[model samples]
Target: MRLRIKREDLSAIERHSKQSFPLECCGLLVGRRTGTEFEVLEAVPAENVKRSPTLFEMDPQFVHAVLSRAESRGLTIVGFYHSHPGVGAYVSGKDAEFLKLWPGVAWLIISATRELIEERRAYVYEGDEIRELKIEVY
Candidate 1:
């Protein structure tokens, strides 16, 4: 599968990830999906209710608002994103557990070190497996 995101949106993720250093940053990916391609038109950064270095939980109200707004703009909440401060852009066991709940939603993982974004990876869970998705910046 393919995930396409705007350059500005990618930069926004980097900036948010950097600013939330030491604490994982979480957000939603707003856009549309066509066949095998998921195109992200916006990055809706949400408050990390958990506010922990290793964990992140998006505020429920914030998620609802974003989802509602995206729908109004003819967009869908196709996926979610989060930062992994000081770690590799790979899914951890905890993330896997969360993935089970999201099923087909795309998971965007950003790795940052000391306020600088190092890498960005995307994945999708299917049939009890986590598979990486190709990213295309536009």
Candidate 2:
């Protein structure tokens, strides 16, 4: 599978991740799924209620609102984006469990630091394993 996102949208997500610094930053991936690709149109920033460096929990009310707005705009909530500050971009144990709730939706993780954004990886959970999805930015 692939997540096709605009360069600007991805840049915004990356910038937010950096701005959040040591604390984890999180957001919604708004787009539509087509064929084998999730065409990401926007990366809507969301409040990380956890405010922790190791864990992130998107605000429930904000999630609900984003979902509603996307639906109204004829878009789907394809997945989510978050930064793993200091840690590399891979699905953590907690994140793997979180993916179960959203099924096939892509979970985009930014491996970030104050100095570098090492990687941007996206994953999807199916059955028992976390599968990596290729990301395309244009």
Candidate 3:
């Protein structure tokens, strides 16, 4: 599977990651699924209730609001994105635990250092395995 995101949208997510430096930032990936690819339309930032450097928990109320907004606009919550400040862009054990709950959802992991983003990678958790998904930013 593949995921495509606009350059501007990538920038937005990166900026959010930078702004939330030292703590993990998270948000929803709102867009449409096309063929074998997920085209991201927006990166909707959400408040990380955990607000911890190594963990992220989206606010329940904020998530509900985002879901309602997406449904109203005919957009699907295809996946989600989060930043791992000062860490590699790899799915961690905690991430896998959460990813498994959403079997077909795509996950975008952004690795950031200080105020700069180092890498961004996509993945999907299916059948108890976390597999990498090709990410095309254009």
Candidate 4:
């Protein structure tokens, strides 16, 4: 699968990640999906109710609002994006558990610090398994 995101939106994620550090930042990727491609239209930042450096939990009410807004704009929840401050961009145990609730969507993780973003990695859920995806920034 391929996850395509706008350069500005990726930059926005980086900024949000840095602003939320040393805590994790979470957000939704609003877009359209066709076949094996996800085209991200927006990166909607959501509050991390967990407010912990190693954990993140988005507000369901906030998510609902985003869902409604996306639907109104003919967009869908293409994926989820989050930051791992000071850690590598890899799925964590907590993240794995959360993945179970959201299937068939891209999971984009960005590793960052207060100063800069380190790396970015993406995955998709398929047939009860998560597989890495190729990311394209436009």
Candidate 5:
């Protein structure tokens, strides 16, 4: 399946990736389900920073908070995003393993280096296997 991201959303992702350089930054992909398409509503960054790169444990309190906020507005958590510093935009073994646990959720990995920022890639997990999904920014 293809995931279409608006220009504004893409910009937000880029900004967050740059702002969280060196340390992986994570956030939620909020949107509504629409006829096989997920129209992105917003990209909500996590305020807590207990978990950094190599690990991401979304605080239960924060999750509840966001869910409560979203509930009132009729939105939902669609997927998640994170950055990979110095690594290419490809699924690593650890990522694959993680996907096994969070199946059906979209994983967006932004790769950045000291000199340049690589393209972002999205994937979905299906029974321990990660299937790359097409991403169209703008």
Candidate 6:
């Protein structure tokens, strides 16, 4: 299965990525599944620990509020997103391990550096394995 991200959603991700340069930024992917399609509803930025490479903590309050809003809008938390400063856009082993427990969600990774804002990539957790996802940003 594949996911389709609207243009506005891509814009939001880009904006957040630029705003949080030097430090990682995190957010939630709010959307609903229709038949085989996953339509993104919105991209909600969540608070993340500043300059912490070993840890990523999405603010509980922000998460709660976004989930609440998604529930009200008949949507759900489809996945999570984070940037990889200098590293390329690929799921790390740690990321695969973390996603093992939540196998149904998508993992979006963005790589931003001095040269360019790299393209985003998606992944899925199947058991302890991390599989690359085909993502189309529109």
Per-residue lDDT tens digits for candidate 2, residues 68-128, read 9999999989999999998889888899889987788889999888777989999988667
Best by lDDT: 4
Candidate 4 displacement at residue 66 in angstroms:
0.4
- Scored against the true structure, residue 82 in model 2 reaches a CA lDDT of 95
For residues 36-98, what per-residue lDDT tens digits would candidate 4 score against the true structure? 999999999999999999988889899999999999999989999999999999989877877
Ten-residue stretch with the least lDDT total in model 1: 112-121
Q: Taking the tens digit of each residue's C-alpha lDDT, what string does model 5 give over 90-119?
A: 887877877787787778888865445687
| TM-score to true structure, per model | 0.94, 0.96, 0.94, 0.97, 0.83, 0.87
RMSD of each: 1.1, 1.0, 1.2, 0.8, 2.3, 2.0
Q: In model 2, where is the ten-residue run with the lowest total lDDT?
A: 124-133
Task: Quote the positional error of residue 45 for candidate 2 in Å.
Answer: 0.5
Please, what are the lDDT tens digits per residue for candidate 6 over residues 17-123? 76777677889999986654556778888778555643467877788898998999889988888887777887777777768877878888888754458878888
lDDT accuracy of residue 37 in candidate 6: 54
User: Which pairs of residues collide in model 1?
Assistant: none
Full-model lDDT, candidate 6: 0.77
TM-score, cand. 5 vs. native? 0.83
List runs of model 5 lying over 4 Å from the truth.
47-53
For model 2, the local distance difference test gives 0.91
Clashing pairs in 2: none
Best by TM-score: 4
Ranking by lDDT: 4, 1, 2, 3, 6, 5
